[model samples]
Target: MMRIVVTGANGFIGRKLVRALLDQPSLSGADGAPVPLSDLRLFDVVPPEVPAGAADGPVTVRCMAGDLSDPAALGAVMNGGVDVVFHLAAVVSAQAEEDFGLGMRVNFDATRALLDACRQSAPDGAARLVFTSSVAVFGGDLPEVVRDDTAPVPQSSYGVQKAMGELLVQDYARRGFVDGRTVRLPTIVVRPGPPNKAASTFASSIIREPLNGEDAVCPVPAETGLFVSSPRRIVANLIQAATLPAARFGRDRTVMLPGLSVTVAEMIKALRAEAGDGAVARIRFQDDPRVRAIVASWPARFETARATALGFQADASFAEVIRAFVEDEMGAPHKDPVS
Candidate 1:
């Protein structure tokens, strides 16, 4: 039986991932074989909401809440014999920029500590570890198309912290301490809830709020390009990453997930196509140079040949991303089945 631990299990992506794991109760081992999942441990700074159907599912779900920066709390997180670890916790881009110390403690220190915990325990074998990275890792002067082999030149504090995490995971994996893999994700759009502190939050607000019968603001210009993917595709790719044969990752063990390359004007066009002129009118353009500076630093296009070959995918179109929010969160009669 596979016992897995998911840090940051209460966040948006974390909650969705837990729900997906409950529905499919399994993960892929290093040998590319099925590993039946029997236990799930959810770790977060706050109490994690247990998945609704967890009691009836085949997997045992437990929520462990505490400040991970504390050594005792960190040790407890890795207490049980673990087969896999999914590290999803992080400080958002804008928030990290505002509070440098807080970001360093949470994003940088916590990640290194968690990795040490895995190296200390895992008596049975090297645990399969998935480190969630971001496209923020790439900034400064970049080529027209960012590739899997492109070098990282982080321009923000958050990006720098994530870049450090990526290297640590890579070196640890290289040393045989753990079977580690890193996934650098793009901007996720049409998030259901209110915006958080991420510098790219406006990317979602422009689409989400208008559909929810509220006005929204577009801080960047109409031509401002963004690399985005839907929550559906992100979740699917996270799960698929675990199932892939370890050898496919080679020495790099990092996959730059595919994302749609779109401009702000195109997103509004798609939104209007789905929700009509009223929804289009709900969006008001207001320039905020701070948000623009951070968003601009991120590359809007990537050559994700490695991820595609590994079977990860991107959302079909921006229209579909808006539709997904409606079907999944806006009370549509029929919901898309778990992919």
Candidate 2:
């Protein structure tokens, strides 16, 4: 039986990931045998809505809500030994940029504290830790297409925090403190629900709001492109990173997940294809230099040979991604699964 812990479990991706984990009968161990889940603890600042009847199932599901910055709160959540941990708590791009202090406390300080807790709790360093990093880690002067070997020159507070987190994960893995892996995720598009503080939130808002019969504002130019993954694919890749053998990551623990490079114009076109021009008409462009500057700094292309070879995948196209959000989140309608 395996005990797992998921931080930031209340988040959109975290909620979906937890449900996906519960759906799994068992996780594969290094020996290739099924490791039955005995207990699952979800930690966040807010209590996550657990899937109905999850506690009644074979796996014991527990939700702990409190600031991870508090050692006592974090310790209580990890009271029992944890076989696997997913660290997803963080401050988003725009928010982090706005409140550097808050970002430092949650994104940097809390992460370090969590790493220390994991180190102390699992002295043998057998814990499988999955840390979700971001493409924001790369900024300043970037190449046309970021590759496996590209060096991160972060330009924003959020990017700096994530870059620091990646280094911590790599160092912990090297010191045999934990079997850690980092997934450098792209801008996740079509995230369900209302907009967030992320500078990239508009990317989702433009599609999500209109599909819900509401108006949405796009702050960046139509020509601006982004390297993005859908929420579904991001969750899948995160799970894949956790299941793979530690040796598979080798010396570099950071895996840049695959994503689609779609311009704003192309994304809106996909929305039109699905909801017609009427839905497209609901979107308005309102340029903001601040948002544009921050978003534009992020690299919009990638060569993810490493993540691809490791069996990670991305969404096929923006149209399919929009359809997925409509079906899964909005309940608009279900389309055939894209290959």
Candidate 3:
């Protein structure tokens, strides 16, 4: 029986990950699939809504709501016997840039404290730590195609903090304190729920707006290209990271995930194909230079051969991604083409 602790259990990716874990059948060992969630601990700022029949099973799911920035709170959670720690908590890009101090505290300082706590909790090496990094780590003066060997040139405070966290996780892993894997996720699109304050919030909004019969504004031009992965793909990669053999990852502690590299226009075209042209017409292009500049600085494409070789996969096209959102989150096929 493996004990798993997941932070940010209420956020977009976190919630979906937990649901998938809970629904998973019996897990395997080293030569097989991952071990099942016999004892699972979920921590977040807010309590997550567990599945209806979650409590009726053999797996014991415990929920803890607390501020990770507080040492005392983090200590209490880490004190529990934990085998796997999924560190997903962080301030998003736009919000982090807005409040530099808060970003530093929540993104960097708190993360360091958590890693230290993991070290202290399992002095004999008993846990696997998985950190959710972002593509924001790459910025300014990028080539046409970014590879795993690309030097990190973070442009925002959030990117800097996330990059720092990645270093810390790798260092801790190297010390044999915990088996750590850092995954650099692209902009996760078609995220469920209302829009967040992230600079990348528009990524989700562009899909969510039309689904709800509302119009959305594109801050960047139609030709603007970026890397995006659906929420399902993000969850799948996270699970793979947790289960992948450390020997397979080698010395490269960080991995860039696979995603669809498409322009805003292409994304709209896919949406229309799945939904309809009316939904596409609902999208209004209103350029905001500030947002455009921030997005433009990000890498438009990546060679995720490392992740693919490790058996991680992403959607083939933007339409497949949209259909995933519709099937998994929307609960039904699009009634209106715009929807």
Candidate 4:
């Protein structure tokens, strides 16, 4: 029986991950039989709308809302004997860049505090912690294709915080305080919500807004490219990261998950292919240099050999990405967005 804790459990990826975990028969234990989850604690700053029948399964679902920086809040979820921790909480890119202090408190301080809680609660050092890192951790004169060995040189505050968090995770794992694995994710495309402060929000906005019958703005040039993954793949990879044996991670635990390298023009082309030319027309290009510059600093190509070898997977194409969004979010008989 696994006692699981997911911080940021209300966010886009977090909510989806919680749903997946609840539906699964097991967490893929080594004994051939599945490891049934006994308890699932979903912690977020705001109370997440609990999914229908979330608590009706064999698992006990606990919804918690509190500040990540608050000790009492961390204590509520980390009472003791937490088998796995999916640390998904963080201040996102542009939001962190806009408010440095808030980013530090949530991304850095809160993360460190969570690690401490895990250390104290699981004195036996048996907890498996999977931290959702970002590609932003790599910046400033990156190679054409970043690899597992590529060093992190973050430019933005959000990137810096993630880089720092990665280091802390490595050190904690080294000291045997926690078994930590950091999966550095690319920009998640077709996120199922309205635009937020993330410079990359336009990536999702271009497809999601138009599909939802709204006009959308593109802040970067048509040729601007980014490394991206779908929400479905990310959620699956997050669970895979947690379920794998601790020894499989070896000495270094950071993994750059596989993603599609897509330019804005290419993405629009895929959107057009999926939803028609009218959907393409709904996007108006109005470049924001600040957003452009921030996004431009991130590397768009990677040879994720290590992640692939570890049995992780990537989306087949951008078309699949868009289709997945439509089917999952739109409740589709699959209507064309232009219609």
Which one is best on lDDT? 2
Which has the higher lDDT value, candidate number 3 or candidate number 4? 4
Better of 1 and 4 by lDDT: 4
Return the TM-score for candidate 3, rounded to 2 decimals: 0.92
Off by over 4 Å in 1: 123-125, 334-338
lDDT of 4 by residue, 16-107 (tens): 99988887746865443568898889899888776778757788888899998999888899874698899999888878988999999999
The whole-model C-alpha lDDT of candidate 1 against the native structure comes to 0.86
How many backbone clashes are present in model 2? 0
Task: Go through the candidates in order and give the clash count of each.
Answer: 0, 0, 2, 0
- Report model 1's TM-score to 2 decimal places: 0.94
Off by over 4 Å in 3: 25-34, 333-339
RMSD of each: 1.8, 1.8, 3.2, 3.2
Off by over 4 Å in 2: 332-339
User: Each candidate: what lDDT?
Assistant: 0.86, 0.89, 0.83, 0.87
Mind giving the per-residue lDDT tens digits that candidate 2 earns over 228-280?
88888898898889999888888999999999999999999999998999899
Per-residue alpha-carbon lDDT of candidate 1 for residues 239-335, written as tens digits (9 for 90 to 100): 8776676677888878899999999999999999989899889999999999898778789989999999988999888888888788767887545
lDDT of 2 at 259: 94
After TM-score superposition, the amount by which residue 95's alpha carbon in candidate 4 deviates from its true location, in angstroms, is 3.4
